[model samples]
Target: MTNSLKNLTSILLLLFLAPIVIATIQTPLVTQTQLPEEKKKEETPIVYAAQLESSPIATEITEPKKAFVYFTHYQEAYQPILAAKGEKVAVYHPESNITTFQEQINAQFAFHQVETEFLENYNKQEIKEYNTIRPFVLNALGHNKYDIILDIHRDSMKADVTTLKVGEESYAKFIFVIGGEHENYRWNEQLANNLSDQLNKLVPGISRGVLVKSGKGVDGVYNQDLAKNLLVVELGGVDNNEQEINRSIAILAKAISNMFFQPIAS
Candidate 1:
């Protein structure tokens, strides 16, 4: 055979073999035996929003830091929640109903002086209660020398997907909502931003998102008053089971503990 013919034949042979050779080169299969030791995490329990205490990590994070939390709940249906969670209620007058008592009541708020340094330092404390949010906060602030005032409320939303999952159980997720329509809009949004960021980071998708609500129903403008570092947290909604809501709080306690003690910004 001519040298040119031999060269052409060799080239053709190489081209044909290339396809077969390429087929064998593949990523090593990650077989069952080769899989990592980490087991798949269990799904979170799906339960009611009102019963958010299913997660036990709740109290581990709350360290009596001159903080006061006020909930805008109807007097008739909230005591059980208060008792189960080991939360204290500073009712103005035990004889009178909280929701029915229209007159504004005030109290001083604070933690023990030794631990007072952990409390927030308010630049101003001129609280006015012409609306819903203020009265509840004023009452709490009256009794404790608290720099941080949190106005709490329950949410109401359809729960097709709002159901939050964390470490083998599903619970109603808490949404930190702020209303931009109010005067202290930026500060309010910042607090909500901090909370939502932490919850979603530690347990992805547990936060519904920061809502800038406007209009009448979202009343209290949402208590963005009292101080710059106010928190308005919506525990859970009607669609969420009570247990789920409780667990969300438990997760929240961990987040709160981190915010106060571990300043590693979520």
Candidate 2:
């Protein structure tokens, strides 16, 4: 009887322990495997966010260069265009003058992402035009910083000296005049030389080279003392018509864009 009782108790204990072991194996312990994968998914977005923050496009922004265009001799006119309209004077016109070039210049500069401001209205009655325009230019400079300042003028010389012909197209030639009297004249000369080189590279012989004037009977300073980059550009002469002058303005705009605004390759 004692042996039978002991055997029965052992059988009952084995049957109870077997179901617990089976249940533990059948139900998977997924927490250990799934935790690492969840962490990896969470870290991926953080790494991608860091990469975007360090990108050059996100960090850097460059603004377009600004140029100021003015005319000391606003009435300077083209002879051919004047004659066509039956006007008497070849060099001067009250209404139709070099100031009209502001439209063309602004249009061309806009294409190259350059901002331009024109000081068109000034006292015309003053005999000393350069002196009259000086105050206005100084005031403009005081208010805003200009990268380039141009005093556009027309030469008294004829077409042969002021025109360039490339194939069938005629272009008005450019002459960069620097004042030799100023203390900072060399800096202005260097700027002129750089532009001359750039212009010639675009269209050979389009520039007549830089000319320095300083002695008596000339406005030696040409108001260039106000700013180092201020330059007097004699665009064409009395003989160059509207079409030629327009072509030259377009070329000049491109040269300015390339020299000052374009980025250099390493």
- lDDT scores of the candidates, listed in order: 0.53, 0.81
lDDT of 2 by residue, 1-266 (tens): 99999999999999999999998899976788799999898754211111111112121214677899988888889988888788885688887888877877877776655778987465665634777788989999999998899999999889889998876678899999998998999988999998897788777888999999999988888899999999999999988998888878877877888898767768
How do the predictions measure up, each by TM-score? 0.55, 0.74
Span of 10 residues, lowest total lDDT, candidate 1? 105-114
Residue-level lDDT tens digits of model 1 in 117-207 = 2112321123223264455555555566854455555555556555765556776677776766768788878877876876775667788
Error of 1 at 202 (Å): 2.1
Top candidate by lDDT: 2
After superposition, the stretches of candidate 2 with alpha carbons farther than 4 Å from their true spots are 1-62, 264-266
C-alpha lDDT (0 to 100) for residue 25 of candidate 2: 98
What shift in Å separates residue 136 of candidate 2 from its native position after superposition?
1.0
